[model samples]
Target chain A: MTTLATRRQAAPGGSTTSRPARSGASSVGRPGFAWALPATIFFALFALVPLAAVAVLSFTSWSGLGDPEFVGFENWETLIADPVMLKSLWLSLLFIVLGVVTQTPLSILLGVWAAGNQRNRAILSAIYFIPLLLSSAAISVLWRALLDPNFGIPGQLSWLFGDGNLLGTQSGAIGVLIFVGMWQFTPFHTLIYQGAAKGIPTVLYQAAAIDGAGTMRQFFAITLPQLRNTAITSIILMVVGGLTTFETVLILTNGGPGTDTTITAFYMYQEAFQSFDFGVGSAIALVLVVVATLISLVVVKVSGYDKMNSSLEGL
Target chain B: MKTRPNYAAGIGSFVWLLIVAIPLYVMISGTFQTREEFGDNGPLSFPSSFTLQNYADAITSGFGRYFLNTVVVTVGVVAIVLLLVPPLSYAIVRSRSRGASFVFRFFLLGLAIPAQAVIVPVFYLINAVGLYDNLLGIILPTAAFALPICTLILSGTMRDITGELYEAMAMDGASPARAFFRLVLPLSKGGISTIAVFSALQAWNGFLFPLILTQSESTRVVTLGLFNFQTQYGINIPGLLAAVTLSMVPVLLVYLFARRALVQGLMGAGGK
Candidate 1:
């Protein structure tokens, strides 16, 4: 291995370091920092710069008019004492938990089921993927119309939904949000699990069947364990997606029934855009960034995703 | 190849199919009915007669303009991503400098930064630069947010180009730029198409950036237009459903024609 490495390294133009080149194979071309400069600057200007500004702006008071005044933790202090802010955090947690809990299993089942090559499964999977074609805004709007107390499906099936006022109460509103979320996102995650399930080695399943395992037993012993990585990926997406959910709450509930569904993302939009309270909004935005970052960090650490960077050694 | 049917799994999936299909049936069927008929029949009822009036009403009520704006945004975003991400990905995969890896890590960290988290400052920055209420404002940030995932996918593809290929090109005395054009571009076609589809969908379906940055009807994207249509014509269920149906037509067309590429692109978003 070392000889092969040295031979590759000794090739002319292969070395980016200052070390003297050894005589051997012809030099190989390699890209330099110049190639990466454009995207780096662009990303810094749009994403990273604004990220820093969110932190700085969180310490000041601004309402989208006049100059911002430095207030030294004032926004943070206010948010610490604010009940809506606290409750919004709790609601955000609830959204994440519900999203993962509902989406993970359902998508896994649908995915594994669809992985079969049967003609019916193929047709049904295609239909299942249709929801993914619509925008979040469109899905929310469609659901809002479809859930109207007087005109929607609930009205038609009043026996199943008494009063048919699904989005008018706290629990009712949250349920609608979760149900809509599941409807919109399950297809995409199911696609993920489908891909993962398709990749599972067939030999493992054959061996399980030879052991006289039943369908449920083979699924529990083989399919569930094999889907672990895909589950983590899907769950992380759900968490991040749930944390930043804005469109559904905006169009469907509008944080209504008295802030019942005002998750942190929606509250930030309300404070910054509607109320023009940019400072407090920035404070909320910073909290969102911190929490998202922490969660991502923990997952990366636990999953050893960072160590996957060793693939770069081949360069 | 044959075994007993899995009744439990089959039953569960059939129930989920009902859950998925009923809403879609309502939305499509509702769009074909008149407003009074729709309201009287409720969302679940079959359409008594087919009418194009709801779709016509949706088009006349600024959806045409919104469609144009969304198309522009999608094209602009795809163009920018195509120009920027491939070269960046090439560098991350082939460059040996520590700075190159650092740049890669920077974007990796960016994968965790949700657009909503920095949206307030983005709004402020767009206003400061006089790009507020402009489509360009929406294009730049939307493309920027897309870079991280695109970079990851493209680099993963580019990395699969073996070291021997580079050496073969080097033996011909090709420069890095020459090697990139000749070697990287052709091989990474799959990755390029994936990113194009992914970014185009992002721009097409984008709601938050346009919602915060641009306000006027002239600049409204389809998603925001759907939003405003809902608020302005809250009681017009048929028209609203028609608008929702219209917004998905382009994607549905793509799904029909390019289903494999679209599905591969979306699954790439899972970072495999």
Candidate 2:
């Protein structure tokens, strides 16, 4: 990489670097490194420093106002013994599972069905895309009203839904949380899959058709195979989104109906801000980060993320 | 390519659309009704009388203040992101050095670290820096969190610019900054616009930063304010929904106009 940079510097025709490669130009005047400094500094001050602080803070018994006591794994021990933490962690995982199970297949189906971008499909796609346009807070607010027992949509449609209220029951609230997530994001995955589907050369499917394969066969044989990489990408996105999602759940139920909807992030917020237990909060935060990183790394390795772009060569 | 109706797909699409649309209708329509109408007629019912009273109530009751705070933070964050990301992404994509790659990787690491993980320290950090209760507290961290993805998208877009364009600018004796403004900036409009809208949306909708970093009513952004507003005015559902609808306007308008770019950008970002 260093050689590439020096060689590129020697190539007088290329001016990609922020510093022009002019004859007799001083090496100290290269602006490429300087140009990137602001973003790097901003990132260091905010992301890197805060990350390290959190890691360090997790090991200490510190409130926001005083000197931290180096407790050393006591927070982690407390976390293990805490039932609420365990429950919140389990619920967070369940929410992610529910999201992946429901959203991935549904998005692929929707993507395949809408891939052609027909006129009517375009109109329907616009309608389907509406949810993606709104803020999660707005959606949570809207759903909160709609889930109201007396006057909202679910209540109005009680004849069909059996008078059950969402936000009030443990199981129902979790279900609705997952449902809302799928509702808001399925369009996103569908759009990604649609773009991927379009990238597949039509000739493959057409040739299959000429060989007397029906639409179903052509789909399984041609479309599904081609969609594999995109499907993996979609799963990575879906899982990460599902696991990290807290805003809608936060606003919709605030992890209420007795903490049924409280994911780890929500629990962390409650601990740190509401309860002012920064040590436990920081520990939860580290745990969440570690778990999320492990899960995402596994997903990436399984999906062959490095090979995804290259595999599109067949298209 | 005949315009033949595929009834199954059409019906499926329509069903999904309805699932997505009904709540939106409920929210907007619910905002237009009086609390009496809302309670009496059920939220799904069309309003018998359209009223601006809810809007009046929302604006009068702290929603307006929160809206302005949100606008300030969103504008500040977006402006910083756009100014910094373009040049940084340009540098990363242009300079093929080990140091540049390390910087790029460092930025990407931000994506994995959830804001929740850093919120503990971030809260204290803001307090330590004396930015607690300041909008800058929210702006700095929010912009920082937004950098990784924005840089990723911008660098991807920048790398796609043909090498010939850079060569031509070099031959013209244009300095790198001059070429960036004269050649790269003009050519990277799509990517720039994408990240601009992306960053703006993030800042507008961000809940965690404003919730954690800022404490005073003066520093509150809309999302946090909306939560508090709902709790305080829990009984006045219409007024709450009205505030919700009002907050949706700015972003809704942005989405309507930039739907194409937004969709392309999101897909492009995710596809990578």
Candidate 3:
């Protein structure tokens, strides 16, 4: 503990003293790397270490029993040929696209609407936030009961949903998943946009009003453009979230009627836990990581999120 | 404000509200009806009879145990996050060391690593460490995964503490730890509570960790319990719906009490 204190003291002191020509007071009470070490090591042990292990495990065969035996590319080769694996990747992409397409405009409108300080808007926003309270597992279970072909809403509204095999057919199952995803997540994205909308300079809106821009014209001209960064952040979240969605599928359809909704993440869980094909699961997991990483990199590049470091530079 | 109301947005949000409310209405209303009544009346119908039997059955069928276990995990996760993230975020915001910045970037990259992608190895590692089927197994990994986002949120909060505050603390000859305790901690209450609520929700709502890491009835969390409850009581829709409602009660209570903080905390997830 003495060494820790001195090192903490000396590091900042040394840096400040070396920069004697400049003001050093701000650095005097600054923390040291020791403060970050514990969480870094803990996060690495659990997240990063296993992340690396997953990549290696993808090249080996194991079943949660014995030591993983190296099989060098066989898992990859088989995954390449597996139709379900290929289809699952497509399903994951489709989910992302559909989630973005459906959620973005709806949330943007709702968020802007909710950003109003009016009493009714506040009450409605609170009610809208209800779905966000339930866990994905609970929401899935709730939807399953609500969409039960025999006695659910679909049954009562048979004119709209004949025979109500929503979970039986491929398109119907996908529709349920997308609709549920929107129901569960739009409020969250709406919250993000609401916060961003609140941040958009009121002066801009006033100026737009002065220019005789109607609400529609002002929203198109001011609100959407100002929300660009938030849109990127929200979309990236949706992408990553869509890629890793598992519990909803598990509880709702169990990758359904015949792996029709088996996105890669769910497929990986099934392969690893259900089928006990750890190697195959790891391979699918690696694909998920690579896909997520690629998407993140693209977003960072496009949105300059990494460049947000500039804000921390002097501090 | 506009002089006139916007009917398009008004109607759109109202429509969306119906979409959001119907399932919630169904779930909540369904729990009050008997099985025969529900089957006869259909999900959309108002219940002819209201009974607390579904909730009683849910509790009697081990939801209490699941609730206790979930509380344990949520508390464990929130504790770990509170203990670790503040200091890490503090270092990231205040430390000048290269290692600190590198660690910050490391966690920034960690934001991309989803828990599902690493579950296979995590399972192996947990089993190897004899934490499988244990609550700690769920707690450790869940807290670990929460670190990236929590660090991001707290660090963002910490950075908002202007340089003048630190310089003033330095003028008082305060040590780093003293400054952290006296100034940074007090100033960062918003971030701290946000992370606490965020991690607690993650742990409370966690399904994959508990589903994969723990198998026994003794370690069952609410989400896993509800999942299993569904399969075991598939035909008993009211009981299943009641279980789902039971799982949401704690979060709903928190929501009622602290809606603003909860909403802000969730918005923090978007890095706002």
Candidate 4:
């Protein structure tokens, strides 16, 4: 606490008292606040103000063209009753569940494999990470072409899955979306887990091996517990990513064979931009924000995100 | 002390490689052949007649305009970020005042708010300000989103610079601003480049803002342009693949050069 206190007083350009021992002790008065002002103001205009605007607009009835009439809870009431909106929220949750279920184990296994000091680690890691380099738009287009019924991979190997494209049906489209989502993001989780695993001292593993602990035993006893925070981070990241998924749904299925894969973000985009129901759309967007914020707050509590920030703050 | 053959690990690697390579090969090979050849021969076959016609068509058919728009937006956002974030990071590092700390915390809090959540008001707000369908509209918000992580990385690296350096510079009668340029910026080159590549990548790959914010062809970026092109030329599979390949080539080159720095930066954020 004393160190923090003195550090506050020791800030370079703001103080007048003579503290020449500290590095920033110039005290020549250039106001560090001025340095941060432009970026801070930019953040205010773009992020802070727009967020507040969204909150306010959620209570109003407006088309994108005219004066917004104040309508108390009307938009909210409609959102609750709208089956499509409800379905969108449910589908978003399903995407998250599917993403976690399919991606987590594969990422963990890949992380463990990559953590080993193997001879071909560089090439192997790069190969696994190729999806990270491409845009979701590109990936969607590539997959869509590869799944085309007449000319795609499935069509070429016709006996395996029959003649129809996987993306042409409702359940198949959702399944493909989940599969592609996992394909793109699993490498990111692998990278995170590998990084966390690399930080573990190798001596612990070596000692455990000498004590006759097998690879699986060492992994269960040491690796999982050490990666708990990273796991939490990955979960939070995936949940947000899943909720905000737009490009894949947009390009691959367009929320189709008829609204089967429409997630909340895409639905909100449709309500506002395509349909011009700005009021209802704003309400939906606000609801999404509220849900995301609640989840993030829980994440901060459970995952020590604030504590991590504090420790990083000392730097 | 004896070791197993590890056939399982090798097989797993092979399976994962096949998973990544299949789609990549499909896309790349499609770019090299004519549409009829691509369709009749099937996607998995080797392009028997490799030609650059698909690339030529992709370029001549307004792909250059979208590519240039993406470059402008990406460069604009990265430039604004590099200019503003470093100074703010310097401020946060040099000052431990409550306001500074609060501001730093505020910036960190911004990470939790994905732009998707705010796109509703962001849309109207941009419209209100008459930036609708404009490239600057996208650049401003993208730069705002980029600031938090960039500041975090820069300030984290800046703090590693010794206090003695600043103290010595102070004794030499240098102003804080002079010390900033002469001392801090020079030392934090690694952090600066890391954020540069990271921000550029984010801006390049951005889809949502470009999708909603800019509706006109003049303001269209590559990500949105690819979607429109695919829709408009649904039958022209080879040309579509060529555009996708062109859109990714720049990022692939960047990744080859800065793979280590990017991994380290993302690792730093993850490790936290």
Candidate 5:
């Protein structure tokens, strides 16, 4: 019976929706090819071709200005050993972890509190969402004012409290940067969880409450589990959003105080576009692709987000 | 589920608000003070003397031009994405073949490949195509990337549209074109507005693409225009703050009015 259950769950139907393109199958009655031809070829040439070219360029040595020469594994080996690249990898991880730790729980609590309430909750959602509504560039600028040692809020606070300051020092700097990133992102997660929590039938809570469940028990029993799928997807999206961060860190510190807070993407910026090391930049881009793809695969498998998304898409 | 409004829960939220509101209040208030007052005054202190001088400086420093340019670029991009995405999504859903699915996956891949990584090559391509340092340069690529997710959302909305609607219309010789025009466009208003809001936000706030691809006062976007507000000496803090406030207003207004659609749009993306 167990073996039968395993086989039944392992049914060929699992890949049916995905396999059409996954297997590279081309079939007849293929709709109007002429209809989609322009868009497909445009995306292929512009999007796919560049990505593929960057992948190929990862293996070669190009002056970024002149010709190219094939060099096998050189960029990969350099990437693996490069101190700056490794530091960036660490910083990126630190940033993402900090974001998840600080924002996720807070947003979850707020989202739960905010859901299904008429007056205060809607106002609070609107208020929290204000940050998300503003441009990051604007936020970075706004916070930079608040962080300025000579003229910012923290400086005034420190002077008022005699605690030194919050921007020039390394820990203070990293803290503020993380806080800003968290502040901007927490609302997004809150927004998602609120949607997820609201979609749960109100009767589930009423049903649970009637069974003598306290508020905390009701939260743990109903909201968290119901929001788990959204939590997973938002966490993954947060990681992606964190990894893609450029303007925030760029404006905040320009990677700062001798690359102390530098990230791989930022490092790639300095190496390739800033310094015109195109080959090296391409190599880093390929590394990002690999790392991003790995995280994507792991997240998809673990959370089944793609499956969830596909199902959502199929709706 | 049915408890009275918890005063305790309400307080919990107000504390969080206090944390977020401090910086926002301070920033806006700081803009009202002179450099001396800003440097020394507590963030919560009422302005000793209200000053609009900084806002004046910001307005004079080409806020008008930047605002107009942003409007033009955002409007152009929004118009194009709306025009292109609906028809393209309709084709994909209407195709009913393996090709539609293939093309569908093709657009999905764009989401995975970080647009940042493509900047260098995209720069070269844009320059090669002679769009460099121009408004059209940024508009083109922004529209391209916007296509993917917009297409994704619209396609999801499109596929759910029953074939019978098309069939019923088709009996009157409402050709595929006419069906899309009369039926699909009308029915998909929610999805299309969602697409518009999403694209408008992206285009309005878009920085990296415009920063790299466009140059000079002629085409600089609001996000990049704020850079000119800064100097090697020190940032024009008040001017920049006013600039930030100005740039944020339009989109903030939109979000305020259509937040349901905006949040609903994001949830729909995740749900899909």
Candidate 6:
């Protein structure tokens, strides 16, 4: 119920005594005060309040019903020695490393190759997007079957290489999850690159060709540079996503065979949901928020969020 | 790379296609035959003994309920998105003078705070609200989770609609509300559809919300129901794949026609 009329009237310069007639500006096009009220209330109650609830709850302790017992730094103290939580954190880091390092480069190559040709792009697009379209359950089930070295396609391929059930080993399972992450996440990055690559005027490439630039030269000079904002954002999302991956790993291994595949996000969920440790769970989740926030800030910096939009408009 | 995609490129595309398609083909192929046949024929072979019985078995075994439930949830979520996001975007763009930036940023917070971040609290909140077992529970949260992203996209797109359009409409004796309805509404159909399709897919594809929020068959969406199905009939690969394929049909049809807008929305929201 904050009065926007006075504020709108202020508008960086104006004055105290306002015109009642100009108060309409505060309403904008909304029908009446009563009309926009529910919506304003909904956004605050659902989004702002719940978000505030998380920020506040991160510092307190309550298990669904009780008056939350005030716990000082006990939750933070627990994560200091929590091995499982630590392992999950490490595992999450490992997943992010493999995904960003390997998956991104492979996708860049795939996109470069795919964009160069028009034939079957639709089919390839469908293929990549198929995994994306799938519900997470289906992705896990499909990959689970596919990774059945004796029975799955990848398993069959590994048979040729002699290591059949890669899902059995700790490193091997992590590898498989990374592979799945890449398979699913690549299409996302590829789409970005595909769009950006297409946006590069053909004239630039033609001019490069006449100037004796080869494919590699053209890619380095034009494609990579033009994809600057996208590449930065793409990597940002990959790191954040890789860190948060849950359903796939949860379904695939359940951090399994012995704590092999656990990301920070999934690990915290297990602690909160399965172990019922709301205190430590909240702490761990807060840590994740901090980590994710740092990562996003990096993205905004590297991509220069302020300029990316304006540059796109210029293009 | 510079050529007009010749036969060699066609061959390369096939290689990549095989990498992508073989697994999907196997998943479909696996659905038609029994586990033993799946074993003997291998995943690639055309089902030597094709049968619709697996599909029939899957359909009879709660698949119909699951499909109905999925439809209800998707329709509910899409309805919520269409109703909420456009207005929210409209408000954010038009109300620039009155703490509108903060209002916009408040929603933008949901962008980074993935729905997963609030799962525990949401579960608590939903249960407390007594929508715990109802389909409406999932619909509300899914809609909530989607609104921020959808609103963000629409807000950006709405901001881009040349102000001249609104000005011209107003000069024609149209009120601000009429200009918004007549000019802004029609122009934003593409962006809004993008939000609709995007939110629909997210709701459809979501596993986490349904898995944690709902507890029984009466309200189970396809993701959770399918997961439970796999657990009970782990050995019935054919039945499982049949169930998965059934779940895929509706979304697949929409995706085929609207891949462009859908992809654009994804890249836009997902890029950050």
Against the true structure, whose TM-score is highest? Answer: 1
Report the C-alpha lDDT of model 6 over A170-270, residue by residue, as the tens digit.
97888778877766777778776766666678889889999989777887898888777767767777887887788788777888768767677887787
Please list all clashing residue pairs in model 3, or write none if there are none: none
Question: What lDDT tens digits, residue by residue, belong to model 5 across residues A14-133?
Answer: 757555652232222123556666656656655777788787777887765655678998878888888989998988888888888888898888887777668867877778877776
Candidate 4 versus truth, CA RMSD in Å, comes to: 4.2
RMSD each, Å? 3.4, 4.6, 4.5, 4.2, 6.9, 5.5
On DockQ, who's better, 2 or 5? 2
lDDT at B85, model 3: 98
Q: How are the candidates ranked when ordered by DockQ, highest leading?
A: 1, 3, 4, 2, 6, 5
In order, candidate lDDTs are: 0.90, 0.80, 0.89, 0.82, 0.75, 0.72
Please rank every candidate by lDDT, starting with the best: 1, 3, 4, 2, 5, 6
Which digits, one per residue and each the tens of the lDDT, describe model 3 over residues A1-315? 354345446766577664553345457678988999999999999999999999999999998898999999999999999999999999999999999999999999999999988999999998999999999999998888888888788988999999987999989999999999999999999988898899898999898899899988998999999887788888888999999998889988889879899999999999999999999999999999999999878877887766775522311
Expressed as tens digits, the lDDT of each residue in A132-188 for candidate 4 is: 878888888777777877878888898887866788788999999998998888888
The docking quality of candidate 3, as DockQ, is 0.62
Task: Report residue A89 deviation for candidate 3 (angstroms).
Answer: 1.0
- lDDT for position A303 in model 1: 78
Evaluate chain B of model 1: give its TM-score: 0.98
Error of 6 at B184 (Å): 1.4
Deviating ranges (above 4 Å) for candidate 2: A1-31, A308-315, B1-5, B265-268
TM-scores of all predicted structures: 0.95, 0.91, 0.94, 0.92, 0.89, 0.88
lDDT of 2 by residue, B68-174 (tens): 89999989999999989998987887764567778887877777877778888888888888999899999999999989888888887787888656755665667
What is the Cα-based lDDT of residue A7 in candidate 3?
A: 45
> Model 2, DockQ value?
0.53
